[model samples]
Target: MSSTHHVTTESKPVRLLLIAVAAFILSLFLLLPLIAVFAEALRRGWELFLASLKEEEAWSAVKLTLMAAGLSVPLNTLFGLSAAWLVTKFRFRGRAFLLSLIDLPFAVSPVIAGMVWVLLFGAHGWFGPWLAEHDIRIIFALPGIVIATVFVTFPFVARELIPLMESQGADQEEAAVTLGAGGWRIFRSVTLPSIKWGLMYGVLLCNARAMGEFGAVSVVSGHIRGETNTLPLHIEVLYNEYQFSAAFACATILALLALVTLGIKSLVEHLSGHTSNSRH
Candidate 1:
């Protein structure tokens, strides 16, 4: 018989000490910046903080940010669901290639992504003449912002879903089909419940990125105040104008969004774990 030795309590204390040191360092880097954002935001007292958000331009940025995220998230959710379903439920040629292509957004530079759209829509661009002739405008417009947001946040849901659903296998889906279940029926009754957590997680990340997308949206937005400016670009304008209080106030909203995302993520994780336990 092989013998196993227990780990010593002496080494346990050392491990705990090392963990404490790492935690301290991590908190300094991550937590400190978060704290700084809040501190700077509130430096001018509550009155200015409230006033900053009340500005018409600030309101416009908030609306645009929400609009972009609202549009982008749903489209990505559908795309992710479809991509995941196909990749996981069927064996097809070029499957790996398709999956790789899905991840291209992550590999590409945001600036380049925005520029690509520009080259397709700019005044002298490929489709520019035709679009202009047809009295259509896309470049330097809300549509351009929406498309750029969609491009940048595209992979979030699919990346989350593909692995989760793949591990689930096609067994249940095949069984559903064997029992004469339709495509929509199988997806609704079976696949939806299984992948809900991962889907939510993906949507969360997608929304976060959609709201905070700077580089790509910047190139397309044209920085029009109370018009094309999203929250991040608005923040940039505030900082440029030496409106530190206003800039920090906008930053604070995003910081709150980040916190909300974290809270929802934790709840989903807890619920997902509870579900697995119940099934077991």
Candidate 2:
């Protein structure tokens, strides 16, 4: 028994060391390009980098990107949470079909998704006449950008919440109901607390995607410089126009945003683990 225990402990360290090495190699491969971008940005010096931020077109792209991301993240969160709740908390026909549909964006190409939106809302398309009559333009506008983003990011929150909610079980909610707690009261006190971390995780992921989304948005936004153009689209525009420094600078900012978002997600996950343990 002593020899067996020794072998088991020894094997665990070997397994962990292998995993650590593999992860390190993968991370290095992933980070090389990002490091190259930062190196190039610095090569151009700090003054140029600072000036890139002050450029009028860059500023417009930043503002539009932030606005679209801000608007879309909350809306996606609401839709995600609602979908998660319905799918996880209830049983109904076509549940599997609904879940599959939620993930359709992941499988569909972004360009194709853009085309579908165009077909639905373009001037000669399905809702075009109605929208034109009301002067409510969608395609080639901010509304189109938002709609495209929402479509692509629809699954993030729901996917995050479903497993968390499922793991939490319904015991606490049942207890609240037994005590005559109302629906809102039970959800606020029990459900929300249980899933808040997961929800935030999803929101952060959605925000990142919304900020970086390009293809679908580009198709609908019409690439109007300083107007419908988002950050990613702006980068493409700059690259196309041979403004390499500005494009790289904008790309670097986006990379930084993604990194910050990832850091927050890691912190949230850490806190969530502590919260989960304390609840036990």
Candidate 3:
């Protein structure tokens, strides 16, 4: 017979000191920087902050950023849902390899991912001539931005769903099918309700990454003011040109987005927990 022993710190003073150290590090590294971004943004006054966001280049960047997120989020959500369902509901050869492929974005550098597309679509690349012949511009355009965002955010939804679905298993889905429900019907009636919270959590994270992605989008985007610049790229441009207030002003938007994402994510987790407990 064997027993497990749990080791824990019992000294109150040591525990208190550890907690204090952690709090200090959190404040110094995370909280303070966020505070500075907002303070610096609003330092020149609210009017200036509003004006900075209202600038032509700034507004354009906002639009492009929204466009990229709007396009990429849905595409990735669909792919994630399909991939997660396929992986979790069936046993197949090369299953592990397929999962590794899905996780490729996380392993690859964002810059390298962007460059891979460039190599495939840029002038003198294999498809470049074909694209040019068709008068379609991909690299250095909206298409490239959307594609890069999709790649970087590829794993969020599927990663969120795979383990949850695996743990939940396919018993309910099989039962629904036994009752003569079709694929879409079963998915909507049974599977969706089971995984909706996880789906939403994944989507929120995907949208945040889509909006905030910098390195990949930067490589694909030409940084053309009022054209290809996303919010992060625009912020960099402003800072490089010595426009500190405008840069921080733009940063506040992204920071606010991150805050909102975090709030929603927390709420989702709480609601999911409450529902789970109620079910049990």
Residue 185, candidate 3: Cα error in Å is: 1.5
TM-scores, all candidates, are 0.95, 0.91, 0.95
Poorest lDDT segment (10 consecutive residues) of candidate 1: 1-10
After superposition, the stretches of candidate 2 with alpha carbons farther than 4 Å from their true spots are: 1-24
Clash count list over all predictions:
0, 0, 0
Error of 1 at 93 (Å): 1.9
For model 2, how does the per-residue alpha-carbon lDDT over 1-280 read when each residue is reduced to its tens digit?
Answer: 6777666655778989989999898778887889877777666788887898789989999999999999899999999989988888778999999999999988999998889989999999999999999999899998899999999998999999988888777888889999999998988888997789989999999999999999899899998888999999998998898767778888998999999999999999999989889888
Question: How do all the candidates rank in terms of lDDT, highest first?
Answer: 3, 1, 2
Instruction: Report RMSD (Å) for each prediction in the order shown.
Output: 2.9, 2.9, 3.2
**Clashing residue pairs in candidate 2, if any?**
none
> What Cα-based lDDT does every candidate model obtain?
0.92, 0.90, 0.95
lDDT of 3 at 54: 90
Residue 156 in model 3: lDDT: 96
| Candidate 1 lDDT over residue span 41-131, tens digit each | 9999999999999999999999999999999999999999999999989989999999999999999999998999899998899999999
Error of 1 at 143 (Å): 0.6
User: Which ten contiguous residues of candidate 2 have the minimum total lDDT?
Assistant: 1-10
What TM-score quantifies how close candidate 3 is to the native fold?
A: 0.95
Instruction: State the lDDT of candidate 3 residue by residue for 28-105, as single tens digits.
Output: 999999999999999999999999999999989989999999999999999999999999999999999999999999
Model 3: lowest-lDDT 10 consecutive positions: 1-10
